[model samples]
Target: MTTVTKNKVTDLFLENAPSFGSFLSLREESKQIVNEKGLPAAKDEEYKFTSVSKKLEQVITDFSTAKPIAVSKDTIKDHLWAGFEGSYLVFNNGIFSKELSAFENSGFGVQMLSESNAIALGSIAKAEKDPFIALNTIYFEDGIQISIPRGKKVDSPILFLFFNQANEGQIISPRILIEVAENAEATFLEHSISLDEAVYFSNSVTEIKVGQNSHVHYSRLQNDGSKAIVVSNFETDIHRDATFTSTVVSLSGDLVRNNLSLRLQDSGCVGNMYGLYLLNGKTHVDNHTNVDHTKPHAESNELYKGILTDQSRGVFNGKIFVRQDAQKTNAFQQNNNILLSEDAIVNTKPQLEIWADDVKCSHGCTTGQLDEEALFYLQARGIDKMQAKGLLLYAFAGEVLEHINDESFRNYIDGLVQERLGSNF
Candidate 1:
């Protein structure tokens, strides 16, 4: 087994190693991390419920020999929003697709990295700490560098679309880094979708820096093909008086894992995290979030909800840390799950670690089925059984959706939620 796995890693390395000369040192560092940690095992506390290493190994074996699928401009034209007035940064199978991107009418500063520049300053610490992130840094072909000038708020939201077309099973790694200057504001919307019949792997990493007094809002949609396996990370650094918020909606995927982390480096920072996962058909999703309050008077809030049916499974783990000197820190976290089927499973854990004496912190976790009485009330209102259930579930899922400020995007997601609830009826 050891020999087979070693050869598999070698095969991938030979095929995907970066040709960008300046990244040699950084690649070596990331490779060392991958070699030391490999993939997280079931026994690893952080990955106890999701033992994905074995599954990832199997997919990678196929990735080593798979053929590149065809990607045409027309194939993805329908995926973009009509009359979109903002710029777009697109990636197909983890590589930049110039033919499909729109950079002509961009309002904010947008630049593509020169191999040397992206590697020298990209988020390398996360790669050194996590194997999935390490794999991305070593093999990523190209990445985008987005700069929002000080005091300038973008007129429209920027869209970062990652569309995968894997005719044969393969591995796709997408890397992105964004910097918002002091007093600047911007909104980024990301959509990851698979339009192929093959089972692929998507290992994506995004690093965002919110400068002092800046504001950043991000919304991510993970609706990959049913057989796709995904491991992604969204890490942000919050500077003094900066605010950051993110909303993640996971509607589909076979084995999905997401890590959302925020670090409050200076005083008066505020961070918000919200997510909702609707699962069915043996799907599995795991979300792990961490917020570090390192300075005084910082605040962080997180709420994640899940709805599981059939034999689907979901996991949520949230952690908030307040340093000793982070006096007046305010942190709150909550996780709620509803198992719509008897065979469904959900594991939720909320944690708080505070070293400061004068701070307010709270955490809560809950898992339950639909409210029987409420369902009955809806049924008594002349609604059929399936319709009543859909109504209740729709309301349950709307809490997180309501936070979206984009009308068109929110309505688009609302239609998906409605379709999801009306399934199997």
Candidate 2:
């Protein structure tokens, strides 16, 4: 038996090696917020469904710097985004790759931020106690800092490329910061992909702050290799009258978990979250989201759908919190899952903690197979059994995909869904 050490990096940092003095301040700050002794286990309320302790038992080599590699444009040709003609930031193996990236401007300036720029953005994410975040803060070599000037409406969408190519036992961390100034409107897409067959681990963090009356659309697509392991956290703060919408799709990974938290700090703000996951062949995927309505008249809506097949496992835990002073808050949450095989399993929980008297909050979750009646009805209309099943499965997921405002992006995802469903669809 092997003993698992928790927060090994933090422990090493605190022990006075101080070789990386540049990150000393950050390490100290993180130690103040996070529990440094015990690793988060399955018993922790927030990590009930996801546990990396077993995998962490293995010794992991700390990756602090990356060796620059030359990558041809043709290598990334198959990954070019569709209908996106705005700013682009590309990262390979957690290191920013300049040659493989493309950027377009329609008048307003869009550029990657230097180290000086990262200093200011780092100040905004100082309130959290996350180990993954701590590691990323100190070691992330380069991060894309996107600043949309006030009142500017970007006609096109910005694309962020997080491409990884590593073999067994390798670890990668990519960091990003996005700031939308007051009344500015923009969209961002974060895509993660891997081409190699490796049991690698990827730890990523993205911090976003939406200014007053700003509108931001953020999408995260995790389509890594089946042998990959990923853990990511996204933290966002919304201001008065601002709108923030996010959709997460998880399609591949040996063990994957996403932690999403939104702070509705100001009144008259709206937050929407949507997620979809398709798992098969012993994969394990979990999504845990928290929406906090801390001010009056704030609103939040969330819907997540999952399709699990073979012997795969899926988990969804969604929570909505309405503070006492958050009067007139309207929040709703729902989680639905479809299990295609008897060996497949899904664990879903929708939690609502409301402390406001005049708030409207509700949450519900259901896990089951496709409706037999609906499948039979479709098959009666000349559709074969497999086709009918595929049609019903696509329809089940279409509800969430419909929320995407970009027609081109939505179409691409539609095609991906069909591909995942195979000839049946």
Candidate 3:
């Protein structure tokens, strides 16, 4: 008989779990879940392609104490987007930094999670199902709740900047809850960065609720350093006549895994997702998305693209489910990849499970190198090989970048993408 021993990292998480919170019972329950399930191993179906737990074990030796290093305002200023006139909420090492954060009177309500009586904090994200989410629920130090009042349209965007400066190996979990009331609209940007080349594991969770007749646009940028490992879960519930759109741009990281789940709870709801991951070196990025349509007259669209060079790897698994009651549903999903090196690899799977016969659902995936004829045509011109390759790759990534709605944010992300592609044009 063989007896399995629990990983020390899990024990560290259990030992350092927060004891006080309004959601103490929920946190306790999550702690129990984590204790029983532990972290997902390579044998797990959902995480087979990416071994997140093993990778964490390699880099993180201790999680009992978080050593927070001071980051200057000049350092923060260097990362802020130029011409972005919105509110800035800074999180230093996964804890909300009130002194470093600045707010604009955008008419939205902002409250600390530890002090607010938010009933929907744990309603959208289910920790019982995912161990990473369970870890986040157990170890999150502090978070924020943003509420948009009913019938209000916010003009400026809200940027949540997370700067990690842990000297020793540590575990950082950042939690966020957003609520958009009926007939309201808002945009949010979540950006993650590492101030120094520190070894750390960041597990983050964000839950959003879109009320009836409301619209929400969310964008996430992950540009952590090469020594950082990150796992993030983004879950949202869309109500009747609501629209929700999310764009995730992953540029660099040691090991990054993104789980995005969208649930359409009522009729006439729409959900759209777009993702772009450009990787080099030995970095690994895995994106898993699930879109659930539970009612009639709902729609969903998803498109994810990847460009990998050197020895980097990419994985994408997207699933769409239409229940029996979800008649007249429309869902489409596609994942495309371009491998720029002989050693680069990508694994893509697009799935659709529809129980309703009246629904229109389809999914497809493609993985290949750049078009040789097009490259030859460009080389036939005055463009060199590297420049021509960069141009082609940039054009390949533009399909996903075009879906971003905000002009300023889109332009900033465009510049980042261009830099990654090494294309000056």
Candidate 4:
């Protein structure tokens, strides 16, 4: 891993890096914030369990000199989700692939961030405390933006496919924005994949705003290559009587970290966040989530589960905040993990801060191995130990998978989980 410091970041990256088109002109305020807050060191409380500072130097040294991956149209068509039933928008190497994309959102509007679009937007994200968001603001110029009209409901879900390929140590930035108008409803399925195995980095950001009385379902499934390093931030804003649901699944990566934040600013708003990870080999995954209840009568629920095999490691941090004005707030959080190997490691922390006397809030975490008694019972039933362990692990992770309302999508994810268990366990 490369060593990260204030001097190295300035001398090696900012000083000699090429410009990022029109985005550079709109990054004054964010640059100031990045300079002031800086990147979180290993000693920082927020990033203690995950060695983010140690891994930072590897991602930025050659990031400014990366060239676009050489890919043909046939390569993109061969690697897509076949049964989505909805039109797809493809981003090839972090740039919108207009020629290879289908153009139907089932009454929703789609806008790619052009120069004019970039000029119209004010601020891209609310992650002021994070330095990766600042890096994205400085280098990203294109992404997807979707808007649903008031009271309009789309039956078919929209697909957002991000294909990142860098064979010679490159970096890519992918961004997305979605807004569901008042009383409208929409669903988005996002897939992140790495096309090449060589060392590379992908920094992605997604912002979602749900209007009053609207609902939005956002799912992110990541299965990158072995040499891929990923950092993504997912932020959500919920209004009165609205609902926001997020499902994050991590199946494969060399190193992956996710920072998710949500704010409930009005009464009757509902926020649900769920995460599931299956790690093997030397893969590492870290998930940090924050939910803020700023208004009365708001509710938030969170659950994250992980299965680590071989020498893999996993970390989870969940925080819930109920303000003084958030009377009658209901917040619950839980984190659980199963370690299959003696060398596998897991760190889980669930925290809650509530100021309102009338609110109900709770948090709990557990990290342990599977039950030997159950394995013995399955062995007596003529089942092999490996198959029996896979079965038990699948059943352990099914609780969060049950929340996926889309049956076909749920079944697809079930297949991935089964394959991982059979091979890793």
Candidate with the greatest lDDT versus the true structure = 3
Consecutive 10-residue window with the lowest summed lDDT within model 4: 115-124
lDDT of 4 by residue, 250-365 (tens): 99888898999999989999999999999999999999999999999999999999999899999999999999999999998999999989999999888888889998888898
Candidate 2 structure, TM-score to reference: 0.91
In the range 24-78, model 1's lDDT, one tens digit per residue, is 6766787776665666777679888987776666665454322335666776677
Which candidate would rank higher by TM-score, 1 or 3? Answer: 3
Each candidate: RMSD: 2.8, 3.3, 2.2, 3.0
Relative to the true structure, how large is the alpha-carbon lDDT of every model? 0.80, 0.76, 0.88, 0.79
Instruction: Please tell me which model should have the higher lDDT, number 1 or number 4.
Output: 1
Off by over 4 Å in 3: 1-8, 65-67, 423-425
Over all chains combined, what TM-score does candidate 4 have? 0.93
Candidate 3 lands at a TM-score of 0.96
Q: Candidate 2 — what's its lDDT? A: 0.76
Over the full model, what C-alpha lDDT does candidate 1 score relative to the true structure?
0.80
TM-scores for all predictions? 0.93, 0.91, 0.96, 0.93
Q: Is candidate 2 or candidate 3 better by TM-score?
A: 3
Q: Which is superior by TM-score, 3 or 4? A: 3
What is the clash count for each candidate, in the order shown?
0, 0, 0, 0
Looking at model 2, residue 137 earns an lDDT score of 62
lDDT tens digits by residue: candidate 2, 115-208: 4345655564553555567655655555666678999998887777777865445557677777788989988877887767666677787888
Give one digit per residue, the lDDT tens place, for model 3 in 1-425: 23232566666667666666567888888877888877888888999999988887788877743545686788779888777778788988888877888775777988889889878877899998689998888888778998999999998888899999676678888899999999999989888988888888899999999999999999888999988899999999999999999999998889999999999999999999999999899889999999999999999999999988899999999999999999999999999998878998998989888899998888999999899999999999989988898889989999888877777778889999988788422
Q: Model 4, stretches more than 4 Å misplaced? A: 1-7, 16-25, 59-61, 65-67, 70-73, 115-124
